[model samples]
Target: MNAVTELLAGWMPGQRWFGGKGREWADVTAEGFLLDQSDPVLSVHRVRVTYKDGATETYLVPLSWRESPVEELSSAFIGAVADPHGGENYAYDAMRDRDATVPWLTHLVAASTVGPMRFHPAGVAYIPEGLPGDILSTEQSNTSLVYGETAILKLFRRLEPGLNPDVEVHDALRQTENPHIAPLLGYVEIDNGPGEEASTVAMLQAFVPNASDGWRLATSSVRDLYAEGDLHADEVGGDFAGESERLGEATASVHRDLTRVLPTEPAERDWYRSLAEQMTSRLEAALAVVPDLAEHADGLRRLYAAVADTDEPVVRQRVHGDLHLGQVLRTASGWIVLDFEGEPARPLAARRELDTPLRDVAGMLRSFDYAARHMLVEQPGDPQRSYRAQEWAERNRQAFWAGYSAASDLQLSAGSALLRAFEADKAVYECVYEARNRPHWLMIPLSSLSRLTSLV
Candidate 1:
């Protein structure tokens, strides 16, 4: 246990999705196995690690043991362990081991019941057989595998008790036969004892074969606008306003479906003050790090104050939670929203709480701003190009809002002041996010902050 813990301490920091970075590891303990097989020697262990500051997180560590090293999978090598007979054996990340992933898919197809693990089909009449699978290299927060162009399976890395909102919402959408999303096919879950909630292990969905990611499509349009120089965004060959409008319509439809399937509540008068407090807290945190925020602090607080004073009651319901350009796909049949897991840093209970759907609208609105200015970070100081980027962003923002208002029952066109507050709060968030993660991108959100604060 100590040897493996030491190995993981060295290995975990290097993983792309590992949350704990630059933190001193206190200890690592293997909790138990989700799967244990002897023939090919595959084990999926749940391990908990405590940081130096006493923070702890759990991770799913799938490992494949082999007699000899698979030279082709050299990059996936984790470490070697001693066999009971004292002979040396090899271990690797099971997701990278094709031989190891095959059995996992087979289990899902067969609805096999292993110790403490349950595999169940969601939307299928028949199980697929003999399909090949490979891990996708998208650098996601979680790992995903595509099986013969038929289905994609997302394996959750960080484990939390209770059903994952992604799987929960996808299943609801599939039940309603919602066309704006990839259909959920099946899922794997860890079966807990009585009085304990089950944890989601993985989810499988029908893959969209030729769909383009919205981020790529949106950025490509931005590039075209830049190339056209003096031409307006509408004059550009790759104008994305129409697509943005359609995406807004799709978002409204998904939100409707989510509200229908999940629980909801009306926002109480006090809810606004609570929400404003949260926003104020975030703004103060950001201000401490980004001194430029100090200039706009007073103006931003006024916007938040308006939200607290809003008397008109609003509805709170299940939403996409983390809506952004990257979360949607541009397909032949309009747009498909993906990933309902919410912000990963927040607690699971907070993620599941009902909130105004406009929070999602705010997120997408901020994303448009990001898409506009993303390229400028690469090639800075071109005022002409920068002005064009703003034009493109404004054009799409209006189009998206128009489509959303036309399609949804929500009264966002009224500018209830809460919406503007949400937008301002989102900008404040982007400030701190950029300062910490991408300092060069700080200008984009800071620009929005200046524009927002300039408002009366």
Candidate 2:
């Protein structure tokens, strides 16, 4: 019932991470609890939000506000705060607010037991000095709190009717409810919905702290092996063979659990048709800019064609649509997949659709390329970087794919060809993605697609 004039509203849609910023938000009613009473009111509050457009949606946005934010606030997970001059201003992701993020974690734990919804307890997280904000380098479905030393808590901005897979999966894993993924202490949700009141707004779980992303971890391992002109990742301290094998097996275990949680239905061809159409738009739009892909346009179309018409039998179930290096955590315990929320450009309906497990596999493979190239970007002209990237992608992609396929009982429609199509789709998507978002990072995907020689 509080009528707080959010001056930073307009500034939100401009952000890569602010999922609802592009549309008009009508009726901004607010509710939340303040984590800190002093120093700018660190409140774990949200905007009972709405969006205006043809395909309309409503969501919950966690807002972190202060009387004023410190300089470089985004680095601290500050999203937006009011400007002194009465204009809209952004801070960082709310999860970066230590006062808010840490308290939010403990709050979820307490609420799990005390709240009407009893969440299974998993691990505990305490903010250490220099805890990092969620990876801000890209536009992701949700923002997170990454403790440089410990755990991560994903602050969910968008709301869905059902319990978020993140909360469900993590809690299951934490309670020894399942073992394929990372642990979850539980999650935080409000009691305010139909059938279920107050949906999940955020999740607090064990952070796989200190783990490099799988892509990064793999490259580090490959660097050690590739320097010796070998394709194996078993030579270095960061040897990826074991990790990759485990990640593959881990992904399989996740699918097993998913099959248990989600009911299997007949594979719907219409879903694939619509998906192909959407990808067509993205691919066509990308072709206009990156002429290099013009020749591949037909290849692209032929690729997506498989989505709808592949003769191969299909199995439908939920999957991590945007699995990649950044989405995975390579902890001492093992590799952990994250951010079930799919590609930002995709609508929730489409992203939530059950598709080929290979789609997730494709995403991870593409990420292997990004991880390798990113390492090269750092050292620039480091001979070892090139060799290392390919070796790592080669070794781990094989392991990841082998493990996932074996576990999921999947037989890809075109095997390597479908993989190429996905790569083309992912690369084209990344190209436009980099062009608009990180123009400098355009080379990452462009280079990846360009060098995509036909995989034998």
Prediction RMSDs, each to the true structure: 1.7, 6.2
What's the true lDDT of residue 349 in model 2? 56
Which pairs clash (backbone N, Cα, C closer than 3 Å) in model 1?
Answer: none
Q: For residues 149-180, could you state the per-residue lDDT of candidate 1 as single tens digits?
A: 78888988888888888888898887777889
Off by over 4 Å in 2: 1-6, 10-16, 19-45, 48-152, 159-162, 171-176, 191-198, 222-239, 375-392, 412-417, 438-456
Q: Model 1, which residues run further than 4 Å from truth? A: 34-39, 123-127, 192-194
Q: lDDT per residue, candidate 2, 43-116, as tens digits?
A: 44445555554344444454566655567565554344445688654444455455545445444444433333
lDDT of 2 at 179: 50
Per-candidate TM-score against the hidden true structure: 0.96, 0.72
Evaluate model 2: give its lDDT: 0.61
Best by lDDT: 1
What local distance difference test score does each model get? 0.83, 0.61
